[model samples]
Target: MLKTWQRCTSCCLGNKHKGDFMHIYAIGDLHLSGEPPTKPMEIFGEHWRGHKEKIRQHWLETVKADDTVIICGDISWAMSLEEAAQDLDWLAQLPGRKLLLRGNHDYWWTSLAKMQKRFGEHFEFLQNGCIMVDNIAVCGTRGWLLPSAEAFSAEDEKIYRREAIRLELSLQAAAKQKPAAIIAAFHYPPLFARTEHTAFTNLLHNYGVQHCLYGHLHGENHISAFEGLREGIRYKLVSCDTQGFQLYKII
Candidate 1:
């Protein structure tokens, strides 16, 4: 049986009353390629054929204006802000308040100020900040490559530490909100090895974060994904491809 929205939310947060207040959904790795210059994801895999349409159909069916969608990252394939406009516009037309986090492939995300100026409240960026809706606090930052990744290097370690600090900052902001629960979103996996905890997971554990949403990993990489309960945190992978182009209802 398909899980009801209310049931899922209540299960994740352990609060039936707060879950009734709002519906929260999450999906990432949109990779929306609009117009001619943008490269469609179909070029990489047969699974991506008509993916955008599938996403639109499922999203319109599952989400509502009052709900919130946490887009875990890789939202667009545009090379520049100008090129990303069409893709961004399409996202704005979708239901609910879209909270955007940065993915590794998001090259057009050079400036938060410019993005805010362009789309206004239609899209909310989740870098170094957190937003509260109903009794849930949403927080996150662009995560970095794990040490287990083949491309990991000394330079990558610098970024890894930096991203950890940024995650801390975002979590701190969420803590300040005093929400009933904190749902941390990430563009990168918190742990490379599912069984081993990393600095990112440790911080979340320290802050009492019980639910974490992330993307980036796909295909065979899914085997390494850390899901279910671990050390009091529930981690879930919400990449669009992994979720079958449907929104993963978080609340």
Candidate 2:
């Protein structure tokens, strides 16, 4: 059955409630493949074996129908929408409303309209807009690598600036709602390693975002990703592998 909030179709902006949510959870980098798995994640490490089941079990144990889960990105291993059916179906069966953002590896993600039409009833996609979950505003974009990164190219600079503009658009939408708090999600770490801030991080500060969730780093790369409080906003790395395949409660 659809929850009261799910009944509204105005892109999460129309839904309003009197109280706070039961909880808000987040995790990312699902990288799921259909059964008879073509892109096995175990190659990353033995701990990745049976990762799908691990995520399912943890999700079932932690979330309720009333809660929300922000899936930061890298949601599937499929190259196209048709190929992603099985993985999408698997996520659809889980409990709670899911908010998805784009990841660097999400080639299956086409236009927002197509994705929403396919799974909007159970999932909310955050592109160049924001969603109001009760009094808190959920905003995000697929951020790009910082200019400070090694081998940064002119093309990377273009994409980086474009993503920063997209994030600002989402933040502007959220500000109009006058939400009690703002939470930003990203597929890439907004800030580079050993760096204090970037365009993405500065935007969060400008918007008074209380929390920021991100993913993408894995294995040894995880060591360089920054987390914890920075200039008031609490940033967290929620990659599925980093979190032991468990949902990290944000509320």
Candidate 3:
């Protein structure tokens, strides 16, 4: 475990799941280690601060200690582990066993095994990992954006393919649970900006993954105004930094 400004979290084992009919809360990109910036809303004239209290209140009330929460990535913007600990303490105060994924800005994150050794008693820090939660299979990857075929450079294709492979591998591991449902999580949208049928999305479709959650875009950069929900399946946007960490209830 490491120390930061406010609290502490030992990186724990991930891909360990159990039960059925879980009240899963999906949120990511909180960047929650410091006092939040309120001026962004004032300068940009956006609704940035609109949902902060709402999300926190709703989560504390909705989540029992047994429930599971997925912090999809970018939990902190702290530059080092010591700086991050204070922030993690804030996360620690929240209820539920957590499944933490990586985000591009997570500078303090080390290897998954190290995380497990550190926080094994508490939260789960996952990377290309899977778990079972109450009869549901959960797998996750911090996917990278691939260049589209229209703009596909060979290097971009190679990197995208690698990340895609990692995603599939994680899903395959999670499939071992033979769950009643499957929810895949990522830091970046498996699909591209405003285009739903990207390669990663198609791969997930082929696997028949029933639900998906991701984040990485803000209001200014948002390409899809609509959340990814359709036909009894869920395509959720879980960027907590922007959404004030609103909990996504999977009933």
Candidate 4:
């Protein structure tokens, strides 16, 4: 039987395993223990309604204790890390070793150093950082959205430019280590337009990211979301809107 789960305003994913191979399971924009009917719910509600048990059931059923799980962002609504610690503890109880990245709504995320130290025991966070599990290297950023589809004002361009720098920094850190297969992640789609002129894409291509994952878009957007390989890079949109997270075979 599948394991049952409970919800909490503060959640922290658990990270621990006693296995040889490292498996990666991913989910994004969980917005768990947050204001109800908020963005996360708008995206995953239809599927999650009266189904919290089902979602948790899926997690306990699908993931093994030794697997590596990545929660892309929007983890909680705490105003500070201390408050976050309360929520993070909830995430710690579930199975697996968990990795986390920042999300757009993560208003309380302090310096990555501080957050890492606080949650170091249960969660490993990537902020312009990299880590190796079972020899597979994982690197990621709280990637920002490119102003595609619509034209951007000067201010919008400035914001986009700033995020571009941050993204590159994260990539640079990951590249320095030269992991076997670069697994890049973000909260937004690095390429949502036809033009490959975007800064995020430029960096991704430059780093030769083997696989990229992202989340954020929800609702009807999930249907139109991109999934599969583009060129040599395999990109998968792992938003919770897509029913549930995915189990990736890195081999």
Each candidate: RMSD to true structure? 5.1, 6.4, 9.2, 9.5
Which lDDT value does model 4 have at 213? 85
- Candidate 1 Cα misplacement greater than 4 A, ranges: 1-21
Estimated TM-score for each candidate: 0.90, 0.91, 0.78, 0.79
Candidate achieving the largest lDDT = 2
The global Cα lDDT (0 to 1) of model 1 is 0.84
Candidate 1 backbone collisions, by pair? none
Give residue 5's lDDT in candidate 4 (0 to 100). Answer: 19
Candidate 4 weakest ten by summed lDDT:
1-10
lDDT of 2 by residue, 1-251 (tens): 11112222222333353343367899999999889778999999999999999999999998999889999999998999878889988899999988999999889999888988888887899999999887778999999988879888999999999999999999989888877678899999998554567999888887888889999999889888788887777889999999999999987
Selected candidate, larger TM-score, 3 vs 4: 4
lDDT of 1 by residue, 123-220 (tens): 88998988887668898988888877788999999999999999899888877766667789999998866677677988888887868999998888
TM-score: model 1 vs. ground truth: 0.90
Write one digit per residue (lDDT tens) for candidate 3, span 121-185.
77876667687775666788888765643676878777778878888887677656555567788
In model 4, the Cα lDDT at residue 122 comes to: 94
C-alpha lDDT values of all predictions = 0.84, 0.86, 0.68, 0.67
Which sections of candidate 4 miss by over 4 Å? 1-20, 34-44, 50-52, 149-151, 194-197, 245-251
Better of 2 and 4 by TM-score: 2
